[model samples]
Target: MSVNLNNKKESWYMFKIGLVIAFSAVLAACSGGNGTKNGEALLTYGNEAPTLTQNPKQLDLLIFGGTAGVGLETVKLALARGHKVTSVSRRPERMTLEHDNLNNVKGDFVKSESYASFIEDKDAIISAIGVDASSEKITIYSEGMKNVLKAIGSNSSTQVVTITGIGAGDSKGHGGFFYDRIVNPFLLKEDYADKTRQEAILRSSQSRWTIVRPGFLTDEISETRYRVLLDMDGVQSGDISRADVSHFLLAVVEQGAYINETVFLSN
Candidate 1:
């Protein structure tokens, strides 16, 4: 009878051990099957590669008189927007703005070859050149513009965007008595006459172009708000800050919305 009892006890112990083993196997399977043993941990055991997006191509731009007051700031803004820029100026040494894609070249506007190399591979050109209004200055505003345009047209498929006065060319007499009678007769007759001829040159060029006619330019800060006059109407009749004018020049280039069109901007 004692022998029988020992056999029964051994059988019971084996059963208990088997049960424990099965329980452990179940726990292991459950831990591996679920994302986490509990609800607190994340499972990254078989994560695959992440999806990627393609980046768009960037445009290249060239600036004439880029070191000038408003033009300098325009360069900074263009660089910030990821556009590659080449700045050509009489005093190229004054360009202190640093950017990986910006190039500064020195040249004379009247000599096409001087700026020919710089505009060779450029996509577009912004002529921010300004001449002094002194009566003794023979290279009036229009003459300077003509020289710069001639240089820009020398090479590559570069489009041009340039700024001239509001009462320039056919845009004259737009500001009523203030611009026609009072302003142009005294302060701007010589300048306006030259700008008129300049506009004619730009219009007749084979290269794509835009002539920006702005009224009574000032060094004041911009409100970022202005109007665009497609026709001659409402032009030569309003005021715009130089900052805003530069902004418009760069903005129009990027958008390509105003191609082969003449825009007159004002407030």
Candidate 2:
């Protein structure tokens, strides 16, 4: 009876030690990576990764092209987060967002003086300005960006985020063959050319800026779990919703990551 009791005590002790070791291993796996588990790289598509931190404070945001697409979504999201948003667009009445802190200003991208008053004392500026695919003369992208740069001259403290397509910058080949070879050259040739010029203007500007290149925007609901690739290499072409893009932009503003960096977004 004494020997059996001693054996049982030893077995219980070994089981407890094994359980502690297993729990410690799990903890180490979860805690060591950069917002990732089990040595996985964060921001890789299809990988379970931690999300970017959310910002809770109210901020003053000035957004251009706020009537449509990503711009409209950004305005809605910003207002929902209790931030003061000034939307600059050619048609102010088109912006249907009704909020106490939302202000819609009628302005043209080509003429910065028209909305220069709205840019003052803004915490951040988001430029979602772009020309349509049917546009033949694509000078609006660069010219509008130039106007924005001039409007915010020497204001390096204010964060600036610009939305451009995937083929805008050095991400020419990452959009797959249909986009890289045919669509980019034939369908969006003029538009992409001006977008490249737009990127150049932002790069040379002194303001702290982040250039977001989204792949094939769609109107689907936001998953809120998207990938941000800093470079074009190994990036797969996929469609991401405008809502997701807006979420990422707000995250960038709140988290202050990727400042002075160009990143590509995809689902």
Candidate 3:
């Protein structure tokens, strides 16, 4: 049988197109297709989190203390990713990044009424609350988180990601010898104490919570390989960029990963 050259080329082209479509369908499913789940439009494949998500579901996110270090970084990245982000702070005007999906709202996390109005409609709330390490007694981490939990009463669907430092919780003695003995004791003693209280609040709260403990945060860009340790066995504080932490936070909320668990991040 003699094959027609033009007809043969057409058949091959059609076969290639079919393969492309099949590959794309599987990729879409694995990459979290443009869909919703679990009443809040989350991407759910399995309990384990995917590191790289290509097509993330657009989320309604309320960032309590969104003007803070990690919170501010998350707001910028979330807006860039086209998610509807409500960046809350006492001075929201300080966040000059404007986007169609961005909503700058005046809110003080210390008061429930100040930010409760905004939490009702959010899919997740990232409490990037932090306080300076000082000799003075610190209670903002605990107090503010208490107000946050109150605002999100009975809303377990609203995934809450709270940022605490490495010296908090079981990661206490992991901030390096000098840092754990000197810096943490003399400087961050009060701050870490409050952060411990804050973690307790979230763990006992009604909201689905994931507590994130980032190691020794720095303004320097992260050029090293990122490390995420769900089990902090023998882990110590390492330098990680705020930028990388923001990326990790966004992933947690979007993928609905790490509920009821404490995660450690470093780079």
Look at candidate 3 and give me any clashing residue pairs: none
- Return the top candidate by lDDT: 2
In model 3, how large is the Cα lDDT of residue 186? 57
Q: For model 1, which pairs clash?
A: none
lDDT of 3: 0.75
RMSD for each of the candidates: 32.9, 21.1, 21.7
Residue-level lDDT of model 1, residues 185-215, one tens digit each, is: 5555666677777778778777777877765
Cα deviation of 143, candidate 1, in Å: 5.0
Per-model lDDT: 0.65, 0.77, 0.75
Minimum summed lDDT over a 10-residue window in model 1 is located at 44-53
Give the better candidate number (2 or 3) by TM-score: 2
Could you give candidate 3's per-residue lDDT for residues 202-239 as a string of tens digits? 89887789998887676866343556667656565566
Model with the higher lDDT, candidate 2 or 3: 2
- TM-scores for all candidates: the values are 0.69, 0.79, 0.78
Candidate 2 structure lDDT: 0.77
lDDT per residue, candidate 2, 1-267, as tens digits?
Answer: 247876676576556545545754664455421222123433554422125455578889999889999999999988888889999988888887788999898999889889888887777899897665532568887898888778777854788898988778787766655457655665567788888898898899898899998877879888876677775665646667899889888888876768998887776
